[model samples]
Target: MSRLEVYDLEHNYVTTLANAYNVGYSKEENQLWDASFQLPYDDPQLKYCRPLRFIKIYDNEDEYIGEFRIWPSEKKKSMSDRQVKIELLDCLHTLTDSVLFGYYQLNNYKTDYVFNWLLNKQKNKRWIPGRVDFQRGFSYAWENENGLVDALFSIPKPFDEDWIMERDTTVYPWKISLVKPQTEVTARIIEGYNLKEFTVKESPQKLVNRVYALGDGEGVNQLTFKTINNGKAYVEDTFSQEEYGLIEYIWTDRRFKDKASQKASTEGMLRNWKKLQYTWEITALDLMKLANRPSNLAINQGREIKANELRLGKVIELITEDNEPIQFRILKESKSDIDDGKANIQLTLGNVIGNTGTTIADVERQQEINTNYANGATNIVPYIFDREADFSNPVEFKFFVDDDVRNVNTCELTVDTSHFRATSKGNTSSPQTVSSSTSSAGGASVQSATSSAGGASVQSATSSAGGSSTQTSSANGSHRHRMFSPGDLIGPLPETRYVAYGGGFVATGSPNDIYTAEAADNHTHTVNIPAHTHNVSINIPAHTHSVSINIPAHTHQVSITIPGHTHEIIYGIFEYANLPSKLKIEVDGNIVPIDSTSFERFDVVPYLSKDEDGKATRGRHTIKITPSDLARIEVQLILRVFIQSQLGGEF
Candidate 1:
């Protein structure tokens, strides 16, 4: 056993008693009574040989404060098997009061809580300095002047919820819990108001879920108060809370009225529409396009009509000067939206005419007569006097429209045929010889007389070879030059060629004469000359290109001409007057005598054969004219001889 002493060194007896000897003996066994003499509960030297006792401490709040233990020792089992029970011998009044006064107090050692001890050198427990100990554990150490005897131990633990500590000794408190409040709703509607009543209830953070309300005339209705994020629910403006609460208090409540009842009972307004018809005014003119010759009347052709106001289903009247008035009816409409209320309406009317009863054709003829008066009308009627008269003289006429609209005016026709008269055989121009009733011996001409009316006259003249004649009419007026009638000789004929008779023909070269030989049917009309002639040239006169040669019994007439030939002998068929002949001939220019023997029938032959070299010569030729102007020749011997002359060999 070990003895742990607090302060007095003279208390070594207690130490020796507990260490070397058993101090107490039992009478029954003859052993010591109390001291086992192992070691003191508190001893500085024993503590050096004792093992430490580790102690864990926690506060009242179950928070791990720290650790406490005895100092280290040399012997292993010495401190493990030892126990030191602390005790108080005599409690000092001051010490007890100080502790009871809340400064210091007895504390029970707990397995889960800590106890702190205060030690000072001046106190009785001076040898034992300060300590923090675990519950149910003891440790000891005597006073040491220069050692840290203070110790702490901790149980292996985690702190409880809401537990906190400071400096391993102090304790603190937990925070308080909060509470939420509930809410309620109320609603109402005033008299004559159209809205309903509503009610609601909820906690500040909870949903009201549903609301109830009553509608006017329609009874009560159920409404829901759906919540929003801000912990609010809104009822419709028409709902009052009391009515809504009444509805929620009672389950079944009317929410709608019958459709027929509402319609018949409810107050509403009426509406209507009206229709009208009106007239329009016009102050300007309009026009319409119509077809050609629209009416067979004397209206202004191609002229446009001027109109004023036009209305639907109305009659319109218009007049034409020198004609009758026309009435029209509006028949159709146009689409232009004329805001002036005047609509463009199509109209139809009858034909219009002019004043004269004459037809339009008659008027046209009168128009021509008004243009050329001298050629208009003539006085063909004659007087009955014996001397013949000529009354078919020219007379002029004029026309006019009468002043009376109803009557057609007759044309004022007049003639000045003072050129027409008649007379007896004895009447004479001299007044001294007037004995009209006695003898009609001399054939007499009457003088033309004039009338006051627009009139015409004709004159007659009579004459005898041995009878005295009296002349009348104008005997001294100007006269027109007389023209010569045909067959009257105007000049002496030339002895040479002249185009006097049927367009004459010219002889090729200088022939025998211009007259034909014998003037009979001369088939061998000669270009009379020496024989074996090569070519003939014919010269045609100006404006006399074509000449007809009559072969008394041939099928066609053969005509020929020359186009400005130098010797008037170039020749080809020029039958049609429009086709003038063109001739190419090699002529002998020597002038020959104008004898019948100096002429020849020059037959045209085509050149043939070559002159010994490779050059190609002419073939036997047929004289040709343009197909449009081929003429037949009456001299067949000359024609055949011309065709055969193209052969080159001696034949």
Candidate 2:
């Protein structure tokens, strides 16, 4: 026979003494300490009562260590002595708490606290199995499709994450309780009354049996609600502060399924549980209280309010104040599949933490390792495309590495097609030495194009003296002889020698006060044209010039010849000399119009005519002028004209 002792806490006021020992202890720790006194006295307390005693041990410094206690066990639980000792040791640390039991701090203490204390604080299992005594004609179905019956349960406020399903033989998946026994529900039906205005403390308990209330002409009714057959039940409980009431619930078997179902039932309860009341006093009070609060109330407000950190496929958008979906994916980070923001996410090339060929799955798995290696750095974005992309929609994504924020958008993602071609070509090029017909026999074998004969000359002559002679000679020669000389071409002069030209042509005097001299068109003049270069200066107006020749100072133009082709270079018309401007210039009878007049004055080197042996020949060059072409020139002055007159004159 086993003996026991009981300290009747509620009856003997022993809670005062128990409270003294509960100092600085958490609920778990306190439960352990409470077990030392309460465990031996469960079930038939009088039969298990005994006088319990304990010996307290103290250190040399008078600090408490622990105590040894003994009592009779009401429940003969089967466990090895070692397991019991381990349990006792765990219980012993509860007496000390973290402050005194610092050495025995459990692994993952805070996580465990969150799991056991905070997360497991509340439980709601919607499925409830209750034994029913169907009086004769009544039939009950366990898995009813339409759900003819409902099982309801209650728990305190707040919820947790660990209410998962597990197979159990004896216990129902849901938490169970008995509704307050033999409750009398008295209901009064009033016409034209606000249902929400009813109060639990003041309003008569009405419509007790059914899930909803229906009122007709009946003034009032009394309904008796009793707990059915030793199972969980719920009464018409009203929590006005929380704005909640009770409703019919569905029973389920799986604990997790019950959890979800219970939440739906509670929400339904709050929505449909209407009450009848004659006054709107509570609603008025609520209105008054709401009005007294601050104005311009807002949370997570403003437009284009980008996220501090966004994962790949994090549909960034302009949401209304009411959280309505405005548009589809505003931006795409690389390798994201989620269309909505509410999904598991990974880093992408477009996000702050760039996706570096690391797939979303890979990144998530290796996040800890990569973070450790990089010291919490966001990895570089992978090169998804050699070219840029044309991001059509606008999206702003901002993220921080510590305090440094990075932002990217369509501007950053716009693909550069040129880069892709370059890279692809480079990758495919053969490494072997290539020989092409374009390459000179004496030169390094390559196939790059050359614009002039100088490159060809040097390349061919390279086998002899490495082409140093040809390179220097060709560069200087071509530059020195670009235009034709007098001897290069023998042509008849035009019938008209000089054309009438005016407008800003200031020559020693005005147009009316000019002097003319006839030294002789009489003598048989053999004109000795010099073997010299032709150089001229002309200025263009700052604005567009008309053919009128009447425009003043700013308008200026001149002409020069190169290889029978005359190039009329213009200056001063700064506005007409932009990159896209067209030059409608004409020289002689040939019309050569340069789109722009921005060129500076430079010499057209005399063209040295080559003999059969490739040596240059030089002589005078006669330039013809025409009236129709003169209107296009903005010349200020025609300078440095050299002509020779001889005995024959026509020679």
Candidate 3:
């Protein structure tokens, strides 16, 4: 009889009981076990549908056989007794069948980290991390529609390995390992031992020499495949070509979107195909009889094995009675007993064939290619800068890059300038004229005359009134035409006549006669009358004659003329048509040339600090794009890059 211990999901111990259980596992289906027990009809603790309760089966020597999770049970009732039939499943059921309810998105997270995160979400302490050494990071998204098991299997593991769930008896929690075949064994029957039964079988239906593994392609949801062949050479002896049957498998993970991964998967399938061409079934009892002494009994030497020694995916050697040694891989195993002394163990194994020539180095190289070049850290996302930018002020643009990027030398940038014009005008002064007048006058005159002459004269004399004395007449031989002077005709001519008479008495004989006529009274009257008449006639008059002179008033005029005008100016106009001369570009605080406005696939290496050992440190990195002396015109920029990390690979 085997000792069975029961526990809850939290690993809290329940009760140890003596019972019989039949446990089995198969590659095609989930592992399961069944047991039955009787309890009192009114037992208070017995119940159904209790989740997470489990059972551990151990043999009589206190070695572990297997662990099982308990499911709901069916109860059978009699009048005095009741029996409960309980079914259990392998520990893997929690991973595969349990529903995961939440949103899960992995953004450039390593595959091992993602796996650990999923397990932690279950809130169960049973499952813990083991040998999860994958170097690549992946991006994925899922809703509540997937199980943790599906999500884990969907990731691309490095080296084309498989995940195996196992428990370390010394530790409290179960562990999962990304593993390959690491151990081998041989099963042989002693010649004088009791062997219950053994059988060897070969099935041609399982033989394959060619394989095609389908995987993710470059396009969205696209499918692609890689093919592997055993040989392409013809047989020299038979002069014929050999052909092996084809087997196809599809890897639905989107992470296998590279040629290297596809090739590695196809080769892994070819390796499996070469190993599992035949099947072997072997059953034996726990006890056997010794050949020499028929009465003496001995325990079977190779009947019972340790749990760790005979687990699934382990390789072992089996030699049959015909003395043929066959290397086989254990695909299924079962142990059963019914509370009897005898215990039976059964195994389903497959034959191991030659190697498929696929090595760990090849698989690792393929993994590196996928991680570094294809579907890895390299990225291209479209972005746009402000086309209508204010160039006068400093125009700055920003973008983000992953911390894993090794060197950011692979980048590109581009730009363009704007168009249009402006103007203004003013005025200062106007037009004018002026005039004046004057007048003056002056006059002067002079005359002179002189005369000297010889003259002939006649003389006459008259006497005034009152003197009737003598009228004198002079005659002389020498007198020439003499006229009487006023002084000479003085006083009286009579007196002259008397003196003449007296003197002439003695005088000369020449004289002759004298006449004395006196009209003195009449002459004096006439002279007075003449003076009165002349005074009467002397009367004068004053008068004015008609005269005319004409003059008039008037005006004079002056004028000036002028014309209109204007002025113009331009603003924010660029110096050059194609590229601005005064421009500077700084990326991460480093200056770059702006000779070309449009940079086609230009590369910029980001400045990353290193340790003293000259190894690059991984963290958040910054890239600042600043354009200098830009204004009024439209500016544009475009960019692209690649990222890589050394974190997980080194560990």
Candidate 4:
């Protein structure tokens, strides 16, 4: 089982929570570690727990999960006999509580500059921001954003790298810095194994085959694709239209100021949104502790991965429905209860670790693989198919190799002559010799021969073969002059001519101070802006409040109705001291009593489970806080409700 250690607002170790119930935590909007726990009555260490308390949770292996802090009004205690609940937010929440003022721009700044900038803007006077003596080489630019935390997180990474938040509460001013997320260690989340219930949601509800892409300006001046798309402001996918009809959408991206960019983004959106897609909502078991592994399963090398290695943002393998392994990053994780001493974890897998093939399915498997591979599949680790060796004489094969992330097409191999010479190896033959086209009557095997030319006689000697020697002479003595030259005689060099030096247009002065673009006619110049995206937000001024629920302990059950909308909760623990031998406390119709022990006090922790969907239905649920009157017990039940407007939701 995991344990929670609490500390004073100053971070001085106070007490180790001996008991808690309805314990759960999740990663959401901020991706910060905010945990919830319940106690029957507030523990003396946290009698009126509000905020500013430090807490840390660890598993059975004593490995750190995360560090958290209790902000103002985070604690709820049932006055003596009632239920008490407390929650702690990550120490990194300090930035979220702070906001930046005025417009600020940094051209080429490091991570330290961001940290110090945030430290200076933070309004939390109670805790001094930590110092950053080091910085990352990556430079990021920021224009304006009141949310300093989100602004810092929005920093662009150099490559496919990621930025992460860290904190060290060991010192007075917590040591914090922005560093790259580490994925050095990872565990496998496979089907029929550690992976449990999961939902593969594939829907085409948002499919749009036609898009009216809009950018920049407003109304009449809005940049569009007309100039680039044959005088058309909208783009469409003919193939998608043929299948899904003409589902249209208006894609507005203010980042693009020109028609070409807007048009490009519009076409891209059309292509992407033209088809159905799948989203995975998976629930994986967090069996991080070695003891949690089931001894029955025969785990093999590389398969028996320790669950402890499953950290947020770390890439891990998840076996898909086809039993094919897929690596995806963990975007969100929530732990509700300890099932058989193992935490029940629900995870939202995001970003494929490797190429998951471009297309999800096709009429055929190989065709699907080929098509997706052609489109763009990544990190396949060099593989080939349909290339058999020594099969056909002239074989055709297809292979894939990493070349600037492009896939080359099929290639053929063969040796060719006018007609088929050799069909197989070792079938070649040599050619015979033949006579030349020009030959004299002195043939082969002729030992001697004689010839006469120009009134001269020639004799030939032989050695049992034809070998001739001939001589001829002719006198045609008509010879001419060998060489001659005419020196300096090109009409006397055209009679030297010269004109007086007339200095044409010479000046040494600066160009006119006022200048404008000169063009043949009136035309619009393309205004270029770097390719980027804009984030939309609604400013909801920051605020805080407190919840006080005081109900006395009774023998019967009392109920509290948690509204249906976006509502979830964490119930704390109930501790009773010096209870009589027969005294007991009742919770939700069940009695939770400590095992018989010599200790004078009993720390009672209820085992509460969340609905499979990780929510409470819209209705009244019993929160039984009954203790035997004769026994005289004090129960602290902590309830932390995460409410989103009229609807309640998970924390």
Candidate 5:
């Protein structure tokens, strides 16, 4: 037989009230236990008792079974019988009312560390406990507001790491441990004697072979743990081409932000599924023959054996009637009233192999062991080609142009000169000279008259004869050079030249000026004319004369001669069968605007010439992205080389 004992939260013993019927308590997984008992209205102890008082259950041997706290309630009467229904809650119930407040931050801290910190924090705030045990640790970061329990559970456990919470029997305190599965079963039913009811269920629908994990990346918001290389997905062909069927399971765990960590987690999940593809559920009830034996026991020799070791998180192997063994982990346990201190023990078991979950370390090791390329698959081959290559073929290419390449359409040349010449002259001519001559006939008439007078007088004949002998005389015409001396007035000065006193022409003299000659005109010339008939001959001939001329200082006309030269350049044209409507560009890892002056879409000969190469190299217009955005961007290039091909596409 078992009885209930009452005590205050301070551990002080209290008197037991009468009529303690309906005294059983119920405990649920991860929840508080509630127990109820009835007390007679006439009991005086009820007046002093209050809620929050503790209650303990003891067997006939006075061994403690469990304990709970009193729940506040009002007294009531039923069927003319007055009784006080007192509610009691287990120790875990105390935590439900303790609200966590303020900000808390955990960086790379283990779950156990946080649990201990929470316990200490609550203990400082008047929440007392007998003992506490937490042995598991999880690595993660927690920030912001959350409840104590919420924050504790937020720390994710790797697939392989297992943790459980249960009250220690030896001490009245909570115990959390990284428990393992037991090798043997603590209880069983043989010959179906003590077995009251049993049910078995197998679920194959829950089988899954693939898992995908998602989380927040370092800078990006969302990231997935899918096999990818160079921004493209690398699907596992073998898994998709499975012999049986495809069963993919996608799991989103935002706790992991690192790629390696996310990969490990997904791998762990897949490993877990591969270990146990389906789940088996078994529900059983057992009845005991011996009253003193523990509720948990194994069947043997037709007599019930006590197996007090059975507990949550423990593994058990059951032998069926046909001697087939089935392994299960105890998931749930419950006790129900039958009659007079006897109880029915119900158990729920699941087909979960012990220690089968995958660990992060194990996942990481597996990833290292697996080759990057899938089985029987080759790596991608890159093609490189010049920009002028024929891309008519359907293959992609990495086309590039050199910086020296020029697009003639976008170039201009200019030339300028400073001097030139044309034709002009200034001349001086001499004035014509006029000459006159007079001739005379003479004494020939006197000779003829002398002969007639000869006889008149002999004495006069001598004089007459002399007179008759008088001869006719003539003067010769002569020419003399006109000389210019000092004090000579050279009238009507030429427009650009003047004669000086020394008989030399000057270019700096004033034009059309009259000047007086100096008194130094010492040289003279005479011209004479005779009265004789003379024959005259004149000669005039065309000829050129060499003369010294002076010119004024002036500039020559401007003339320009632009040499014929060419602007050499190379251009690149990019084409894609399916190019993105929009694109982003970065130069030397620096993001630049995608406007007309910088980068833009183009068709036809999309000229990547000297103008475009001014800012970057053109060997291979390599598109580079940060490690974080590798998964976000997907672009591929294919190369083809040809002699001379027209570019006709848009990028």
Candidate 6:
């Protein structure tokens, strides 16, 4: 018989039990797979079944079925039989506790960046992903979701179904490629021919034709299909209205930026309401298990059958009542063991909408709406920078000076004469002279002379009383002339002309900008400027960068323009708009402060603007920000008005 194997967190073999009875694993669409079995009251390896350890289930062939997570100390004991029953949870359930920290204001996030970021960042070791495929193209925006599961479900099924958020059966167990509804499988569930028993169900519970699709704007400005649909804001399906009177549904998708797309979506939704939803519950006998096996009861073939052909996520042909042919896929499966060895597997088969991500149309929304909205906005994001972001302190704006010297405008410059002296290499603006001559009977005493002007000369002549006398009188000295003596002034001082934006610096290219000037006057004076703000430090409490990160336990203050209108506000409580957790929002005029649980909980109502009727009350409301020591929180408040008031007419 197939056995149950236990592995530690590291996947090292811990224990194996071939003796477990009534063992089977079942799966539900979009939910984690579950399994349960009874062990003898005195089993020794029961200790290995604690939380964090993993359990693997296999069929009699011992081929891989799937892996499940264990919860701490969940065991049921029947005193009369002394058998203990333990239930198993799939690895995805751990996401229920793990959280993405912070509030996000997502504009248009790509399909893969959303997944990779959630699975690999700012989370505890509660769960880890084995593999993640990077998907290009932005698919989601301005939305909020709860657990990782709910957040993932909010994403539309990728065109490549393999890229949907799903887990593997064994290899790379946490990767998304689904295991079933696969085109490669050849499986059939035929009436009486193979099905042990079957129940057919048809319901109009989720059927709809009149879709009231609403998008981003509020009040009369709300984007709707009315303009393009002649006179009706809502499009009607003739078939559904004929068969079921009228089924009305409201879809508020804030992601839509315009009306034309809403028209196409409404028409698409009209097409799906043609028929009532259909489902089939069956207890299909395991045909492969009884082909040769004789030891196990033909009725008890469940234990011997892995149901490989009818595995979850696989598509199968079903010949129903009256030999009517229809295609269905296994969506949900339940197991039971009756007396000795007779085991039965009940399968919930449905032809629901689905991609290849999971077999039972697990990717479909539980609610009725235009599935087209699931194809989230695919417009190329112009940019992803948020106006309000959580930024690290001391942000730096660099001013890079180029290697080559920049040109300056040719102009005259002047400064306080007391703080400057007029002098040049060869000449000065004004010339001053110094000349000296001595006539004496005796030879002239040793004398030294210097001139502040160039062109000063010396002449030799015989002095009176037969003593030689020299006379020097000229315009000034030669090229070595200077107006000020070296001792008269202290210079060679570096230029301290402060360059700033407004006065001399041009933020953008324009005439008279200092950075591009051809020439600058070289006068010895200071370019004294008023204190400037461009190079000063500033503290912005609520800010963020292109890369979003988790903030510590902190509060952020914000003031946003919230219009008073009737609308629906859905915000993610994971990290940001897409993922936010442990968040708090307090309006200035309101008394009660609202806080969501840390990373794991979400409360959609009362955060933004809302009225008593679940729509927002008309009026401006201020969102108050408190002070704290963590990253500032930014909320992408999306207001969606579902009804139009300006029409002023009855339908």
List TM-scores for all candidates, in order.
0.09, 0.14, 0.45, 0.41, 0.45, 0.47
User: RMSD to the native, candidate 3?
Assistant: 25.5
Better candidate number, 2 or 6, judged by lDDT:
6
Mind sharing the TM-score for model 4?
0.41
For all candidates in order, the CA lDDT equals: 0.22, 0.23, 0.46, 0.48, 0.43, 0.49
Question: Could you give candidate 3's per-residue lDDT for residues 1-651 as a string of tens digits?
Answer: 467677776777877654333333233211223433333444544542255576776655565656666766667788765665556666655665554554345766776787787777664556677776465655554445334654454454323554333344335587765434434453332323434677767665544455444443233223243212232211011111144434433333334434444555555655555433455666744332122423222223545433124445566555456766556666565654423445455667653432212211234434433343333244564555543222454456555555544324344555544321122334433432322333232232322233334444444444343323343454334322233343444433333333454235322222333332222222212222221211122223443344343333434343434444333443443432333444455665667755754455555443334444232344433333333433323333333344433235444
- Candidate 1 regions exceeding 4 Å error are 1-117, 120-122, 127-651
Candidate 2 C-alpha error for residue 326, in Å: 50
Q: Model 1's lDDT to the true fold?
A: 0.22
The CA-based lDDT of model 3 is what?
Answer: 0.46
For model 4, the run of ten residues with the poorest summed lDDT: 413-422
- Alpha carbon deviation, residue 230, candidate 2 (Å): 37
* CA-RMSD of model 1: 66.5
In terms of TM-score, which candidate is strongest?
6
| Error in Å for residue 430 of model 4 | 99
Q: Write the per-residue lDDT of candidate 4 for residues 366-417, one digit (tens) a residue.
A: 3322232212222223222221112122222222222222211211111111
Worst 10 residues of 1 by lDDT: 266-275
Clashes of each: 72, 36, 7, 30, 16, 41
Give the C-alpha miss distance for residue 186 in model 5, angstroms: 3.7
TM-score order of candidates, best first?
6, 3, 5, 4, 2, 1
Q: For residues 1-651, what per-residue lDDT tens digits would candidate 1 score against the true structure?
A: 212222222221222122321211111000011111223445454543222222222222232322222232222246455534221111111111111111111223342233223223223331221222223322211111121111111110111111111122111111111111111111111112211221222222211112222211211111111222123222221223233222112111111112211111111100000011111112212222122312222224543422332322233444433325334332222212121222222222111111101111133433433332211111121111111112122111112221111111121111111111222232223223322333224334444443333333434343333323343443454334333322243343334343433465543323232343223331222233333323334443333133334333223333444333233343442232232132122212222222221123432222222234222222321221111122221111121110111113465
- Of 2 and 3, the candidate ahead on TM-score is 3
What are the runs in model 6 whose C-alpha is more than 4 Å off?
72-79, 122-146, 157-165, 178-185, 214-236, 251-273, 293-308, 337-343, 352-651
CA RMSD per model (angstroms):
66.5, 41.2, 25.5, 53.5, 27.2, 38.0
